[model samples]
Target: MNIFILEDDYHQQGRMENLLYQLQEKHALSVKRLEVYSKTELLLQAVQEKGSHQLFFLDIEIKGDPLRGLEAANSIRQRDSQALIVFVTTHSEFMPLTFRYQISALDYIDKPLDKENFEARVEAAVLYAQKQNRKTVADTAFSFKSKYQQFQIPYEDIYFLETSQISHHVILYTQTERIELFTSMNEVLKQESRLHKCHRSYALNPKNVVRIDKMERIAHFPNGMTCLIARTKMKETLAKMGGEIE
Candidate 1:
């Protein structure tokens, strides 16, 4: 995993680097790269060019600059949605702003640092980064060509796939988007094992299913999207999901 730290203070930056080194030796973490930037603009530029899936340590206040770290993080998120951001700052008040920014931060570490607390949070962040990296490596995406562009749809991101109303096409429902492809349900099902035929027209991703309403024959997602489950397959589907009727 690549780790980036944005802190203007030299002493604080050194401390962070040392802590990272200590953690690496203690945990035997497989860190691929590490970069520390005193300038927010430089870090933002690098992230824009490199893309995310890296770990970041950002300071809320940079010398002579107001909220530069936060602004840089926002820009980073635009490029890398899965970037792990951990705020290392003296300003505890800025903690609430992470939710407002919707950056999906991993954790927050306060300044005037305690070694125990610093080590603990950073270790947690590294563990999270490793887990996310493993997921990306394991879950390969399904590649397809569209009229305008090619698409690579990851299996974990798919809630379900259905036979499109238009013949010879399939509709894939994800958490945030729906993609229509000129493909067959059998072709799509070959991409992943998590997907199963819940009905004649529908294939379900049990990982995305939060609840199964057996009586109503509906599989509910956390996003409030529901799909029909075949009555004959209800017991089988529930078994695959390891879930009971609600």
Candidate 2:
């Protein structure tokens, strides 16, 4: 997660930095980049080139301009509607303007910041950002065609694909469902690179695999489901998984 702070006060900036560092040390927050900008122009420039999963903490008043932070946040929302925005200011009266601007501010933190309240709001924002990241990943779908229908399943929900007993068909195993599709293993492989042929009968999604048993040559999924891993493919699969074998 990328975090951006727009605060003109030096003391407030130091306080936020300290609290964020403590959160990082305690493993309560995962931050890729932490940037502090006293100027709104610079902050907006960074927002224009922003990456995924961003969190912004803006002070409503910047250099006597009361509405500067709100304007900056509006620009951010225009660029990335999903980015998390939080207002940190003493001007509680301006809270209504957030709704008027349609910025969707995540939380409002009062200035002269309270340690306990600050930590709690920051932690909440971290959790929300993590959830949004998971949702984005889960939204990616694997598209394929069945005998009579076309299927699009979220990549995160899929466990594996195996050859069905019936000829020219394969069974797609998901977290809650199993779908029999008239597709070959070769064709399935072509659909998504994430689906690897771990065995002659099984093409498992390594991302959804909970564990790999080297001795048993089995792949365990989250839904108490299991699939075989071929001896010939075990070494290659282990390599792909960075040798995290049991």
Q: Each model's C-alpha lDDT? A: 0.77, 0.81
Question: For this target, which candidate reaches the highest TM-score against the unseen true structure?
Answer: 1
Total backbone collisions for each predicted model: 0, 0
lDDT tens readout by residue for model 1, 1-246: 678999999998898898888878887887666789999888876652122347899998887676788888888776556677999888888878878888877888887667777778878888878777666546654444334323445556778888998987888888777777677888766645568899999998887899887778999998999999999999899888886857
Question: Which stretches in model 1 have alpha-carbon errors above 4 Å?
Answer: 48-52, 140-246
What TM-score does candidate 2 get on C-alpha atoms?
0.55
lDDT of 2 by residue, 78-128 (tens): 766567898989899999999999999989988756678777887777677
Candidate 1 at residue 225, lDDT?
A: 94
- Model 2 deviation from native, Cα RMSD in Å: 14.8
| Structure candidate 2, residue pairs in collision | none
